[model samples]
Target: MERFLAISPKSQLWLFHTALALNILGMVLTDMWEPMVVGAIVTTYLSIDATVRVRYVLPMKKVLRELEQENASLRRKMADVEQSSAY
Candidate 1:
């Protein structure tokens, strides 16, 4: 098992593909068809959430905080710019 989550979009897709392939392969090998398709979708979605939690969720919290701060900064700048630009 990989210890790190995939951060790049390319890796994200590959992870999903890999998950689906594995799920399908396991199901087909066992001669289960209906469950295989459903399992593939479930595993793909779970893989996305799992990848996000492992890779970006924590860092995204901090990014949200930073963006909140930047929002205020931008608002202040916009106010000044608008005031100056007002005819």
Candidate 2:
């Protein structure tokens, strides 16, 4: 649906909650318990996983890259100090 497609990652969680509510309503209306429950559980897991990756994992990756760069610079500085001390 265009509505679903228009949802951004930041707003995806709101959509997930909406979808979850809708799923439960639909299941109740249709009297299909087992399949709908399974679908809801799976969707919840995947949505939470995506949210964590977007909200935490990606930023952590950037932080990791920055730390690596700082570490390399420190190593270079240490090497320079060692060389100067030996002179």
As for candidate 2, its clashing pairs are none
List candidate 1 segments past 4 Å from native.
Answer: 1-22, 64-87
RMSD of 1: 7.8
Q: Output the TM-score of candidate 2.
A: 0.68
**Candidate 2 C-alpha lDDT tens digits along 33-75:** 9989987887686577657766887688899999999999999
Per-model TM values vs. the true structure: 0.42, 0.68
* The 10-residue segment with the lowest total lDDT in model 1: 1-10
As a whole number from 0 to 100, the lDDT of residue 76 in candidate 1 is 100
Clash number for each model: 0, 0
The residue-level lDDT of candidate 2 at 26 comes to 79
The Cα local distance difference test for each model comes to 0.77, 0.77
